[model samples]
Target: MIVIVDYGAGNLTSVQRAVSYLGYESLITNEPEKIVNAERIIFPGVGAAGSAMEEMKARGIDDALEKAFKSGIPMLGICVGCQIIMDGSEENDAVCLGLIKGTARAFPSGMKEENGILLKVPHMGWNGLNVVQPHPLFNGVGKEDEFYFVHSYFPEPLDRNNVFGVTEYGVEFVSAVGLKNLFATQFHLEKSGKPGLLILKNFCIWEP
Candidate 1:
């Protein structure tokens, strides 16, 4: 069974709903045992990183996730879920899961477009990805496909090879990353429509 982790960060239902639409069974829970035992895991969240990590630790979900990752389970992380998989987050200066060697940094101020329009924080809305490395999660995904994004911070993996995709807002930022059995995206695949669904489908069947 696939487990959609719930650490009180919200966004669990939407992820579960999307996975169900793809004809896969999933459970949304904060139960550590369930998470560790899940065949596949989806860690999706929308909220502050410090609070989320606090909840995970309070419920022992942090250890569960680490154990699951080491067991070679295929895992996917979305949004804040993606961010906290790294070493730390500038959001509340919270230390993270360390699944990937990186830090989640806030977007710099004074962002601007080529036309001189000041870009906004939270970088909300649709953006296209520039795939930098080949990965099965992006199988059949095309250049024209745009994904939904809603964030002020983006991940910066310490190892460039861990980056799979990049997207531009005001500056180019790492939008997707993976390492061994785990993969993550700064964009919300659940909200990205068909292209997003395709990635979900790929993850459901992904071997690594």
Candidate 2:
């Protein structure tokens, strides 16, 4: 069974629906045992990193997630869930899960394009991905495939080797990252269309 961490910060229903649509069973819970024992884990989140961390810690889910990762269970984090996996986040001056060595940086202020068009703060729209390194999760995914993104901050992996894909808004940022049993994306796969579903399917079949 796939366990979707319900830390009160994610779109649990939509994520569960997406997994179910792909013909897999999933459980959304903050229970540590259920999460640690699941065949796979989907850590999907939206909202501020600070509050999310608080919720995770309050329920002892943070330790459970670390334990789950150490146990070699394949796991995926989406959006803010992805951000918290890093060392820290600019959002709330938060110290995150540190599952990966990185920092989540907010998009710069006074951001403008080469053509002098002012860009929006929260990049809320479809964006194309530039695959940096080949990985099984992106096996059938095309470089031209677009995923829906809604975030002002993006992860910057301390080790560039962990970056699997990059996307650009005002600048190029780490949009997807993978290390051993862990995989994460800045985009919301549940909100994305065909290409997104394809990614979910790939995750279900991935061995590690």
Candidate 3:
């Protein structure tokens, strides 16, 4: 069964619904045993990185997640979940899970696009990805398809090899990362449309 980590920081219900919509058995729980034993793990998150890290640590969810991933279970992290998987985040001076060697940084204020038009923070709405590498998660998904995003911070992997996709707002940023058994996206696949659903479906069947 798939386990969705319920660390009090995620959009767990929507993730669960998305997995269910794809005909997969998923459970949303904060229990360590369930997470450690899950066939796959969905680590979905939103909200501030500092607060989310606090909750994960207080409830031992951090240890649970690390254990699960180390066991070779395929895992996916979304949004804030993706951020926390990095080494640190600029949000609230938060130290993240450090599962990936990277930092999450906020989009600078007073930003402008190539045309000098002001770019918005939060980086919401749909944006297309420039797929940089091949991975099982991108199976049957188009590189040009737009995915929904709702965040101000984006991950910057210390090792560029970890970056799988890039997207641009005021500037280009890492949109996706993959390493070993872990895969993560800054976008919200649950909120995205068909192309997004294809990602979820791919995850449900992904072996790596």
Query: lDDT of each structure?
Result: 0.95, 0.93, 0.90
Displacement of the residue 188 alpha carbon in candidate 3, Å: 0.5
How far residue 151's Cα lies from its native spot in candidate 2, in Å, is 0.5
The TM-score of predicted model 1 comes to 0.99
- Error of model 1, residue 86, in angstroms: 0.7
The TM-score values for the models, in the order shown, are 0.99, 0.98, 0.97
Mark the regions of model 3 whose C-alpha exceeds 4 Å error after superposition. Answer: none
Rank order by TM-score, top first? 1, 2, 3
Model 1 Cα shift for residue 134 (angstroms): 0.5
Q: 13-131 in candidate 2: lDDT tens per residue?
A: 99999999999999889999899899999999889999999999999999999999999999999999889999999999999999999899999987888899999989999999999
Candidate 1 per-residue lDDT, tens place, 2-31, comes to 999989889888888999999999988889
lDDT of 3 at 5: 90
Best by TM-score: 1
Candidate 2 least-lDDT 10 residues: 136-145
Instruction: Count clashing residue pairs per candidate.
Output: 0, 0, 0
The TM-score between candidate 3 and the true structure equals: 0.97
Leading candidate by lDDT: 1
**Which has the higher lDDT value, candidate number 2 or candidate number 3?**
2
| Residue-by-residue lDDT tens digits, candidate 3, 1-208 | 9999988885899989988888988888989888889999999988999999999999888998888778899999999988999989999999888899989998988989888899888898999999999888898887579999999999999999999999988788999998899999999999998988999899889997
